[model samples]
Target chain A: MNQRNESVEMDNQLAEFSDRILNDEETARAEGLTGELADLEKTVLRLNAAASQEALNEAQSKRMLLRLKERMRREQEEKAPFWKRFFNPQFGFLVVAAALTLFLVVNAPAVVNPDLSGTATSKSGVYVAAGVLTLFMAAYWLMRKK
Target chain B: MQNNSPHQQEISDEVLIRRYLNGEVEVFDLLYYRHLPKVHKRVRYVIPPNDVEDVTQEVFIAAVKALPSFRGDAKFSTWLRTLTNHKVAEYYRKRSRKQEPQIAALTETLAHPDNLSFHSVEERIYLQRALMSLPENYREILLLRFAEGLQFNEIAEAGNRNLEATKSLFRRAVTALRHCLEE
Candidate 1:
């Protein structure tokens, strides 16, 4: 049990040492690398520093900012009322869905009841509802495709 | 609005975020430029070079959308790093769905040992290849610890693990990385 305890202590010490090196805290000199384990520690520090340097693309930054501005503008427009939102393609799905629903309802009476009465027969009502439902489903599918 | 001066650099990310939230939308432009290199580097570590820009952009977009929900519990960079990881994972998921074989091919290319160069370039390339071989969690822990410079507690919180477990994971990750380099 004493040996196991010693092993755990050693592991914790090494872990702490690594943490310090990663944080750039002062530690033992690199010349202390006399064993395989020390060599590994040195390698780890070097690798850590090596990974820290990354190149940035100035051109990509400009392009990304431009796209972000456009997206933010569209988002702002979407927050406006229905009429204002209509100008942005970002709300095209909602627009199409509303349009299709309106079209179905407006034309439903003509197709369902030729008599032009406000009330329709049960069979004709089912047909009208089915037609509206079909149009809605089609609109949904089209929006998803877009 | 181009403020890359030292004084601007002194402004905290949280303060910048607050300013952006409050009417100064141009402050977001500063935040974007400030964090762009970090975001790009983090995404490049996990994603393919070709897709890095798209994933980085997606991370920023998601960050902007979710900014209102950010309650200042963590540093802005840490939050952004977590978002970058999620975006990279999502990118992989989408790619895998579209073409499973492409992921396998990409991994094989990354792991090709013969591609190793010499000097610091060789070391960096070898480390990157080894990192690619590691499990996603292990890679993320190492990146958070070493590259992003997050403390153990911060890493634990970001990873949803306890402090002790995060330390242990970091140790194991270093060991795994060493072994991978040896291979």
Candidate 2:
């Protein structure tokens, strides 16, 4: 807080400004600037080359994109399951179509070669599946109507 | 792309926004890099310095989310500047609701505690309270100027007000701040 220290601080500020002025003059001279304007021209390239700024460079951008994708995926996951895409009666015929696909998938050849004795006495697997599907369809229709 | 072309000399913010929406993400980066410094600076005025960077990030996040809905009734820069203002306002609202009571308690303790001596703490509290109590527009515009370095024209554009009105608003804000700070 003494006069000496105050003057030192002022000197530092002036030096910084003069350094800026000299750089500007050099640039102007290179560009063929003439007259007093050239002399006055001070190009200070305060271009910071040290400690590179954390710009949203490609890597950082990709990271951000990944984060966004992850957040969107999580939100979708928190929503209804994929099957609801079919069961969501708001989908109406689309739901019906998905249901039919699921039905086919569940009943399609499992190659289990059903136990021949278990098959006849227990009733045909296709018949059993048809019966179950009928019940599901009826219940789904009723639920949807409500 | 010509450096000397008159049409290309000034790329309207609207065009940049449209390019961004059309999948030119680099345009978004350009827009972000262009405005982030001012946004971060504004954030510091309302929030503490420590949280300003976080607020800056939040502003950009909000901008990206809201970009799809921007039909561009106004300039894109204006829209972003508004978003920054809104985010800053929301920061204050959220902090006051979540931490004001804790801060008040802390202040009382620090002021009255027997063993610990805290100097200049009361001034800090006074500054915070004075800022928070200002009408939202006044507090916001003043901060946007001093802290954000936005020109008066830009402030008017962002606030969606006329230049004269913006100036009057700033005048009113300074008057209120002076009164509050003095008290």
Candidate 3:
């Protein structure tokens, strides 16, 4: 036969072979071919996997372990203790400065004498002390209303 | 209605991906198991037998890693095939730079069994080698039809061509396969 005719014959044979393998009536009826097909497939896959190249090795495993450890360490770092949350020096400084500023704003007038001990107390200090007292009184009244 | 209700198994790729992003890694595995065979077959279509499994693993790994970034615009399978194409191109790129002796070395690695049926693994390997000998476009259509078991319409969609074009391409691919098998 010519090369072309031989190829045509091979194609036909391939198709017929597939049909026979799939349509094994005796095996299908006796043993459930679908299940057999699945099992056979599993075997084929297992064989392929066994003979196939492996993705694992000591180097790759060590790299993966290192990655896992690093990620865990990162997660642990994320979940820091409550005290450690304040470990940020800049943020702590900002917080302390804010707290001191707030304390000075609230209590500075209390230290100043609104009623002057002597004539050394200027009129401006007296006015400033009065404004602070008035603000505090208003804030206290609003809180009481709430 | 109760009997016909679709379970999580029946849920579409979009929903499954949504579940995956919602913190279910196992859902990705389910999707992987569902799609791996087709991906494996497609990889088998393009490359030689020795490299097919490696390509398959690469495809799966890429897919799994990129799942979180999937934007739900394209169909999951289409996106996956696109990724497959990219890997195939990369393989060819790496392959083209290598010397022929290295490729020839792969021939020895092919297990040639005697007394083989046409349906046997040996024959399949032979057929795969023949398919790989064809041009990239011809190989793609043959792989889509035979290995991947996609319809002509699906091939057209994957090829981004019309149905008639895809049909003619597939016929030509089969004809080419016949010629290759003869050679």
Candidate 4:
């Protein structure tokens, strides 16, 4: 046989041996197997037995699925739109507190000095907005660390 | 909890994937259970026992994340197997960075008599180490055949290679593994 034909023949033999071992172990062992094919068969049988012993049972699988679900949930939360995540209950309280503080800071200046408020309030508004954004970001970072 | 409805079991993976893409989020449970045993088995075959569950979870998580882009050009199982391969590779890459001795750890675990039930633990350790030493293509073919339980023709299809070439590759791979084990 040509090399190609010989290789094909070898592949066929290996496959047959494997199938026998996998589907009918008793009969496969009964065969007077030898050489590389026999070695391969023995390896396959051992691996199969080891794999079965190591299998994750239904309860373990279910527990894994639950863990996966929790992971997927957290992933979805992280991937949610920024504003949506910002409003999540964990951050909601902080967001409400920040918004209330921002409202007071922006309006307190105007109430304090209505005449000078235009330029003064606008200037303070920039500072207050920056400060609130920084505070919000710091809070977010802290929450993530937790 | 998995919904064990009889009709749910009847839906094909492709159909379930489509349903999942179309807002049927719960359909993923069917996909998960349908393929978990084989995926888990394949992971357990190659991964260290302590790390197998984590790697299996990584595979499904990746599949779930990548589902939207799944073009259905290949079977779902094949796609998942490819994904599993990537996760296993990633596990090794991360381990290489940590510089932990994988074989030593495996051997240590095997040393415990209660943990092993199949043939000699030394034989299994050698087989696993030899498997790890194989070239990627050879190792992949072996895993595809014995680990994932793909038929020879199916392996050819998954790899997009001609049957003759795949068969030849399989023969070569088995030879290499046998030689590795012998040494």
Candidate 5:
């Protein structure tokens, strides 16, 4: 047989031998293995031995599950919608900053134009603050996308 | 009605996925526990011990994020296995970026195996090093047969190869492994 054909034949034999050894070990042993086939059988056995040792015990599994759940919870919180995330304690600073910005904008007319009309300035000031916040958010989003 | 009973082992993974999509989120825990052992085994085969848990967690976390998009074209187990492989690859990629070795050094002291004997841990690491040194296809075939516990025919189907080709690959992989161990 040519080299390729011989290699193919050996492969078929190895696969067959592996099936028999795994499915019916006693029968495979009774039939006896030799040559490269014997060496392949030993290799298969060694791989199996290594695999059998890789099981995660109950305690390990439980500990891993706990850690996984904790991480997933954190992940979920991080991926929460913007509005929902804004309520998180870590965003308290942002909330305060927003409130301060609103206050500054509401009182800016009184500071800049001491004789300016009161009610309309405050209302327009509120709109101005909202508009600035929207523009800031849009710019932030664009930057992130870029 | 979707059964949410914790003891309902007969419910299929697909069913749990459907229920999870239908807002029965708790069913995911069932899927997680059901597949954890096999997924953990596969990850353990390739990853270092200290990082195995982290990598396994990353696999499931990716699964969770991607679960909503899963179309059920393939079996959940198969999908999870693929995800685990991706996460392991990503782990190595990040490690490589950080200038870490691919696999732990052969002479590096191994952490004590949780339940394994000292000799077994050494043997396992030695075998792991040998496996790592193999070409990707060779390593993959061996892992499919051993770590994934796939039969030769099943591996052939999974890899989209003819039975003969798959067997031939298996032979070459084993021979290569033997050579690696001999060295």
Candidate 6:
């Protein structure tokens, strides 16, 4: 047989041998098996050990469950309508900041025009504070998206 | 239902899933705890140790989202195992996008002080190192068969291969792992 066919037959034999050994089925001695099959059995034992390692303790499991609960809550909120979503305080803050920006822009001329002096500086200061707050909120939203 | 209660312990996963779908959300906690160790072990085989918990959590979250579509043709544990595998694969895809190091480097960082008791810490580390040297497909097949306790036919179905091909693949995978361990 060609090398490819030979190798496949060998693999088939090895697989059967390993299965019999693993299942503790009575079989003739494995005298004709290649050394690779013996080494493979040893490796399988070690791999099984490595794979079955216990990493989660009760406390860690509880902590993971808690996080999953929080995630489920967040996902549920995300699935809500826009109006429902805005009910969240974080979204409410964004909406309030957006409204303040619109109000300040519309009222800007009255507060800081050259036609109106004296109080223009203080009124402009108010606009500037509002502008800074709007900018901060916008930046926060952008950063969160990033 | 409270997980520790004797009543809850007697309920099967399918029954719990049905209850959860019927709006008894507390039943999900029982499912979560029931399958946590299985999911955790499965994820750890393919993912970096530090990321295993997060990936495991993501798996259940995915399961919760996908639960509505489940038709109960297979056991819930089988469905969850498939989901866990998908999440682990997704994690590797994301890591590759960010140009992270290879699996060997990730496995090297898996040596937490707490995991030393499974064997001599050295032997565990050696086995992990050997596993990291293997191709991803080989490692996955070995894990599904041995660690996940999948029969050869189940593995064939999962991988879309014929039973003989799957057995041949398993034998080759074991041989490759043996060579790596020897090295």
TM-score of chain A of each: 0.35, 0.25, 0.28, 0.45, 0.40, 0.39
Cα-based lDDT at residue B174, candidate 2 = 54
Say what the interface RMSD of candidate 2 is. Answer: 13.5
lDDT of 2: 0.56
Ranking of all candidate structures by their TM-score, best first: 4, 5, 6, 1, 3, 2
Off by over 4 Å in 2: A1-146, B1-10, B101-128, B152-168
- Residues A1-146, candidate 3: write the lDDT tens digits: 69866555444433333234334421222244453234433322322222123323445334433554455456667789977866665454455545545655564554475454434435455456556655655554554423
Q: What is the fnat of model 6 with respect to the true interface contacts?
A: 0.71
Ranking by DockQ: 6, 5, 4, 1, 2, 3
Which prediction has the highest DockQ against the true structure? 6
Better of 2 and 5 by lDDT: 5
Q: Scoring each candidate complex against the real one, what DockQ results?
A: 0.20, 0.02, 0.02, 0.28, 0.31, 0.33
**Candidate 1: misplaced stretches above 4 Å?**
A1-54, A57-63, A74-82, A85-146, B5-7, B100-137, B150-169, B179-183
Superposed model 3: Cα runs more than 4 Å off: A1-146, B1-6, B99-130, B133-136, B156-165, B181-183
Error of 1 at A99 (Å): 25
Using TM-score as the measure, name the better of candidate 4 and candidate 5.
4
Query: Ranking by lDDT, best first?
Result: 4, 5, 6, 1, 3, 2
Please, what is the whole-model Cα lDDT of each candidate in the order they appear? 0.70, 0.56, 0.57, 0.76, 0.76, 0.73
B1-183 per-residue lDDT for model 6 (tens digits): 124788888988888888999999988888988888878877766565557788898999999999999999988888998898788779777877775534443344555545444234446556655665789778778777655667778889988999888878888888888888778
A1-146: candidate 5 lDDT, tens digit per residue:
59989888888877776666556463334346578878887777776676565467777777877888888888888889978966654455456557757776777776567667556667566667766667655554554523
Docking class of 3: incorrect
Where's the lowest-lDDT run of ten residues in candidate 1 chain B?
Answer: B113-122
Query: In model 2 chain B, where is the ten-residue run with the lowest total lDDT?
Result: B115-124
- The 10-residue segment with the lowest total lDDT in model 1 chain A: A85-94
Alpha-carbon TM-score of each model against the true structure:
0.56, 0.46, 0.47, 0.71, 0.67, 0.60
Task: List model 4 lDDT by residue over A24-135, tens digit each.
Answer: 5454454686776677666666655555565566788789999999999999998899889766765774775578577766666565676656676566775676677677
